[model samples]
Target: MKELAGKVKLVIKFFPYRYRDYSRIAAEAAIESWRQGKFAEMHELLIKRSPKLDRDSLISYAKELNLDVEKFTKAIDNQEGAAIIDRDLKLAKELDLYVTPAFYINGIKVLGVRDSDYFKNIIFKELENAKKK
Candidate 1:
């Protein structure tokens, strides 16, 4: 993404797994971190330390990231990101997405992990298509 920073934009939408025990809370923590401008850090921690997204773990991550722990905890306790999550869930359902790590490049649905070239090829194709318009 850094390579294509100026030519591309990345928009993240949450879609926590309904069956996972901590997915929703993790998503909430991520959203709260975003509010504090620490979204990337929290996201990296959450991914690196999966299945440990309990309240304590989240608070620890917040503290580690130097975020306002009080505000983060309050937001998590209040489920402040629920509405946003719900909205994104609805959109995911509409798109028939049932998996994590799904991405839509220029409205093209790509699932799971792939090499950078896989994405760059799609992005380049999309860029060309846009130019044709």
Candidate 2:
């Protein structure tokens, strides 16, 4: 992943649960569109839908951040990046997670994305329980 992408991911980790819905649908839509050669249209939709994410200015911004401009751009343009997104969605689906940002503990569903604290609580409990098995 590009360095900036890693930072963006950490920031995303703090988003309030309610703000993360439809991630799967949106990611799939984006990947599918990009697969169909609608890069410009996809870029427009991203701008219209995610004002904070200014897709149009990403390249310049990445360069400003001192990231590898060519590599970053190439990553986004390839199937790998989108496939990574798709893999995440597929895992979520396999876990029977219908809602965005859902988590599971020992195969038990834990809903919502309230905060890191919520995930920590379930994960810790599950880890303890698993020790007995």
Candidate 3:
């Protein structure tokens, strides 16, 4: 994907499940990290340490990433990123998306887990279509 970075713009939207007790908080923490220019770092950490998204754990991760722990704590505590997360949730509902890994590539929807070959095929097809246009 890094090879296509300049050609493809990847936009990540948060759609944390309500049933997952720590989903919302983890989303908030990611947003906080985004504010501090550490979104990717925090995202990777959260994924690697799933089900450990307690406040202390999140703060510890932030500290590990050398982020401003105080600011991160305040943002999560105040739920500063709730609006963004809520908007994503609403969009997911409107799109009838109930899955974690849904993708919309040039209006083509691919849902569920897919392997690298699947993505490569999609991207190649899209690129060919783009060339034709």
Candidate 4:
């Protein structure tokens, strides 16, 4: 969850603001499936739901972002890019995380789906908790 979400945040940062929300939905859905202990279901979610190829769809997104398509394509096509994913998987294993959207504030970890306020409150509490250290 930590790994993928971080990757999503990085990927989405390159896209247009209009796509940020939609992109998050897609990433969140994948995370939800992982949280449910249903890895098989991730494929269903990743299935081609959009009519256009991600690149084509992202053209306007790139334009809005004022990003260079060539560099973006090169980065996405790199097999080494999956290294981030691999590292995340390893971290998840050490952390005993079987779900997505998990939060690890300081050394404390949070797992599974949660409400918006839940994260906000936890983060705030984490901040206070950290102060005691």
Cα TM-score per model: 0.87, 0.44, 0.90, 0.50
Residue-wise C-alpha lDDT for candidate 3, range 1-133, written one tens digit per residue: 7767757866889999989889999999999999999998999999999999999999999999999999999999999999999999999999999998899988899999999899889898888888899
Q: Lowest lDDT 10-mer window, candidate 1?
A: 1-10
lDDT: which is higher, 1 or 2? Answer: 1
Worst 10 residues of 3 by lDDT: 1-10
Per-model lDDT: 0.91, 0.48, 0.93, 0.45
lDDT of 2 at 45: 58
Candidate 1 residue lDDT tens string, 91-113: 99998998879998878889988
Model 1 TM-score is: 0.87
lDDT of 4 by residue, 8-75 (tens): 22111111123333443333333333434542444243445543325444434333344454654444
* Total clashes in model 4, counting residue pairs 3 or more apart in sequence or in different chains: 0
Q: At residue 118, what lDDT does model 3 achieve?
A: 95
Considering TM-score, where higher is better, how would the candidates rank from best to worst? 3, 1, 4, 2
In candidate 4 the C-alpha lDDT for residue 91 amounts to 67
Q: In lDDT terms, which candidate is top?
A: 3
Q: Arrange candidates by lDDT, highest first: which order?
A: 3, 1, 2, 4
Best candidate per TM-score, number? 3
On a 0 to 100 scale, what is the lDDT of residue 25 in model 2? 34
